[model samples]
Target: MQPHFAVPNLAVPTFAPASDAGLPLHIVTERTLEAWLSQQDAATAGWARTMGFSGAWGQVVVLPGPDGTASGALVGAGSPKSRQRQRFLLAAAAAKLPEGTYALASDLPADLSPEVECFGWLMAQYAFDRYAKNTGAKARLIAPEGVDAARVEVMAAGETFTRTLINTPAEDMGPEQLQQAVESLAEVHGATVTTVVGEDLLAQDFPLIHTVGRASDRAPRLIDMRWGSEGPTLTLVGKGVCFDTGGLNLKPGASMALMKKDMGGSANVLGLAHMIMATGLRLQLRVLIPAVENAVSGPAFRPGDILTSRKGLTVEINNTDAEGRLVLADALALAQEDTPDLLISMATLTGAARVAVGADIAPFFTDREGDAVTLASNAQDAADPVWRLPFHAPYEAMIEPGIADLDNAPSGGLAGAITAALFLRRFAGEARYMHFDVFGWCPSSLPARPKGGVGQGTRALFQALPDMLALS
Candidate 1:
């Protein structure tokens, strides 16, 4: 197993100790780029003209000192006043600069938050080379004075772990592979891991999980990993359908292209688990993942069948394509058995959430006001946006199926995200449960963020967990 690093609260480094100490930096917005450089002193102005630097993302120009040494540098932010803050530009610039520590010499505007700097550093360090070639540029940003180095490393690890898992194709990442990933973390953090596969799931009373994944060539499994001996117990359950062929009800060509990222929820929970264990946060952690592949075959569970869940609740399958919730139901029920201080389940369960919030934002559902605020605040702080939708009781009526205890999916299209939450809520019961319906893929590239399997909610949840534990 690879070595794991902790997220510590170390003493901040002082700028006086920087290798490039006293070096000046000029920040230029797009509108003033040419004019500002033209007005600079002879040596500084000469470099700008030679470089033909326009204030684009990751643009950099350096001026020479009297001894032909480096004098100052000009880094561009496309537009500082624009509402959209391009976070990765500065860090990307920092990474490409010569090997010397540098500070943000320009004055930051009053409205800019510390997150810009924090996320900038994070984006600069980002790389996912698990399976693909990644002989990429090295990250060399000087840790800003007073920055929390430990926390940033922890968050980056979480995000990287998530992206690595999601980005890998399903062929290389099945139920067993998912368990292996969990085991890797367990070994790193000295946690305990247990998994039940195929017939073993039936023995364990995870009938719904068993039924849903039986058709797959690779056997389905449930991964349960534990960490932290004492403190408030916190459980995380994530739906881990490694690949979803939509069973009998198959998805269209465009839709199935990214089915490999179906286990995004499992990736997310593991990422959050990484953060908690790395920080050595005060909480007893337990993670349950119902890992499987919903493939079509003669033995696959049909749409009209009634499936028995770990909680003993019967669910009638309204659609075979809605298999994510089926697996989550079993995992959530298992989580509730412990009745931990807090229960959070995350899944890329419904396309309705995507339709409602779009690709950039993830919508979450929770019962408590304090939990919502903390999650929202942490999400904002992390720059990983998560929106909260009501666990509105009235919508529960929509999931009520005539034939069974509940329906996998309701007949009507209205409130699809909410209805799915209500379905998962049935397994949660009175537990302090919060569910994140995340769109695990980035639709297109934006600034530092690229288009591919994107890991959404864990960063904010990682930051929020400690406070939530304290309140509990």
Candidate 2:
């Protein structure tokens, strides 16, 4: 039987056609509620007050028509101070609205983007119900004027692909399954995929990747996806550690609970790839994913072992749990060989990244100052939210031990996220490189975000690509 993964419906049913007719939705906040109510007739204004609609965040109240049927509704957008701390605030109100298509009648908050709001409105209806059914009257929204309908749909599709891959269990998303995803995506996008699996990895000089995954029955491989024939070269390398059991080091049950999401980097890359190809972005795109499972067996790479990478740098493994970077090291070296204009690696590399920025923010490291500045700004605008962590040249000595050219896990465990980035940088060599240490799972459900695997930096990078490539 073929391995199956759920693909959620992200394009339709959540949005009505772009026709000009939709029920009016009046957006308001606590401070502006009185002024808006003053213009209303006695009955409508009195009914709102009687329903206790004081315009707190996400508060919604429906207005009765002259003949006692539904007319329109009022939604609270909250103050700017409160809006900064949340996402998809209006979508929360949309979820509560009755099953009808609604359109914005009033202007949005000054600081928000109608594009982003529409994207959230569509994403809020997603459900991963592969084995179960999602029951609800899906309240749809009309695509607001001045927003690109196709762009938002592409984002929703990419995001749905990412969330589904990350949420699937390890049994169905191993190296082979992951390759299937790449193949399926390539088939749809007219891209080509090539992979080196099992012992063939050692033949291809991917020793670090093979060592980390040799114990798994499913085998390890490097998935290479190529698309687009013209424009600047952009290579994306994602750490596809399907499951991290910490190898021989062995993670306890608590630490291993969410290991299914360890390949979030690969998921996000594919998501970004989907957006790029579908949106007709001008670029020759290359996606490299080193898919492996750090399993424990007699053949598993040991903590004290030293291995030579594809770049020929020696790595001393102090902890088997640090396998994500090991697999990424070899993949980055392979990507650097092409000398792409910009090389980016994304991985669920270290716990210290989460310690530094929490789960809501994606923390990144890059050697290029221009990329750092542009990415941070674009991420905020895209509502993806990325923070830059330095490459820290002074800490170069931290990752070096007397035994090997690099230490997989430095002693003392301080500045772990930085040291890991520094380690991957060594493999990437002179290629202009960027790295993302992202927490790809949303631990708690909030607004449009369901409690499951999520895409961290994909959208921001999508928005910044044209600028990064100097496209006209």
Candidate 3:
């Protein structure tokens, strides 16, 4: 089996001390290129022109010194209009720099904070070389002035862990492997992990989890991880459908192509757990992941089946493809058993989410107004963009079929994401819960962010937890 916990090498000298000797990295924008050239020496001006350094986004040009070593690097920040539309603008150029360490120049025209760029530069160092021989870029950046390097490293590691887990295909990332990952992470963080697998899930009152995963030989499970003995209790529930074959109602070839990423929710929460534990945050953190493979077999649950959830709510399975919410329903119910101060659930649960916000934005629903505001501000500052959707009470009717308490997949397919959020809301009860309907794959590459599995709302949630739970 492929290594389940192979995250980016955080110990690499990606961010050197501010006092370290390194070349200067100039953050340049298209509007400032000519002005910047005017203040340079004749040789430097000639070099810039010769290299066609127009300061377009992500363009990198190394400036060689008289001794033949790199004196500095010019990284394009693009135009203000372009800068406004993109995230990690500085990282675009930073990721392309040579292997040598470089420090940010004193005269940066862009309004971005040094902390954001530091995190982005570190994020660029990620390489998923599990199966391929592709040589990724090797660039080391010095921790910019006035930045807390430790905090940035924690954030980057969390994101790297999330990406690595999602990037691994189902062949090497089954339910067993997912549990191994949780155990590995727990060991590293000095936390405790417990798992109830197979028929034990039924014995443990997790009928929905067992029913959805009974068809597969790999066996299904509920993974629980806990850390931190002090402060507010925060429980995170992630839907861990290791591989969704759509059960009996199979998805099309194109749709099934990315089924390995069905466990993105599990990856995300695990990533978030890393950040919280590594930082030694003053909070009791609990994570619940329902690990399963929604594959077809003789015992697989089918559509039109009315099954009772851990919350005692009966769900009518209108589409087996919508199994994520079923597993999450049981996990959420279990999470509520502890009566956490804050509960958050992340899931790659619906195509309707991608359709609603496209792939770039993570759309979330929350029960608290103040938590929503805190998250919105933090997401903007963290460069992890998110959008909020109402847990529309009106749509509650759509999920209620006459035969059961709720419908897994509502008819008409209108407001699918909202209806799915509403469906999970039933199991959550009255907890201060937030649900993220994330599109875990990035369709295109952008700077430090690669074109494979991506993390959504983790950063925002990390930044918000301090305020949301009064963890300070």
CA lDDT for candidate 1:
0.78
Off by over 4 Å in 3: 1-13, 17-19
lDDT of 3 by residue, 1-472 (tens): 0112343332222466667788888878898889889999999989999999999877889999999988998888788777777777657776677777788786555467677777888877777778875444577777766788888887887888888889898999999998988888888778899999999998889999999999999999999999989999999999899999999998888989999999999999998888888888899999999999999999999998999998899999999999999999999999988889999999999888898899989999997889899999999888888999999998889999989999999989899999999999889888889999998988888877888998999988888889888877
Clash count for each candidate, listed in order shown:
0, 0, 0
The deviation in Å at residue 464 for candidate 1 is 2.0
Q: Which of the two, 1 or 3, has more TM-score?
A: 3
> Cα RMSDs of all predictions?
4.5, 2.8, 2.6
lDDT of 3 at 236: 94
Q: lDDT for each of the candidates?
A: 0.78, 0.88, 0.86
**Pairs clashing within candidate 2:** none
Q: Looking at model 2, which ten-residue stretch has the lowest summed lDDT? A: 1-10
Ranking by TM-score, best first? 2, 3, 1
- TM-score between model 1 and native: 0.88
Candidate 1 on 1-472: residue-level lDDT in tens? 1224332211111222345455565667677777886777776677776788776656877667779867667777666545255445556565656545456666544344544555555554455555555522333444466666567666667776777788788988899888888997788899999999999999989898899999998999999999988899999998899999999988887889999889999989888888888878878999999999999898999989998788888898889999999998988888888889999998998888998899889899998999999999988876788999988998887787878889998987888999999999999878999999988887775544556677788878877877878833
Spell out the clash pairs found in candidate 3. none
Candidate 2 lDDT over residue span 1-472, tens digit each: 0112234332232467877467889998888999999989999899999999988888899888999867889988888888888788667877788877888899888888888888888778766665567633376788888988778878887888888889888988899989988998888788899999999999989999999999988899999999999999999999999999998889999999999999999999998998899887889999999999989988999888999999999999999999999999999999999999999999988999999999999999987888888998899898999999999999999999979999999989899999999999999989999999999999987766788889999999999989988865
**Deviating ranges (above 4 Å) for candidate 2:** 1-14, 66-69, 135-137
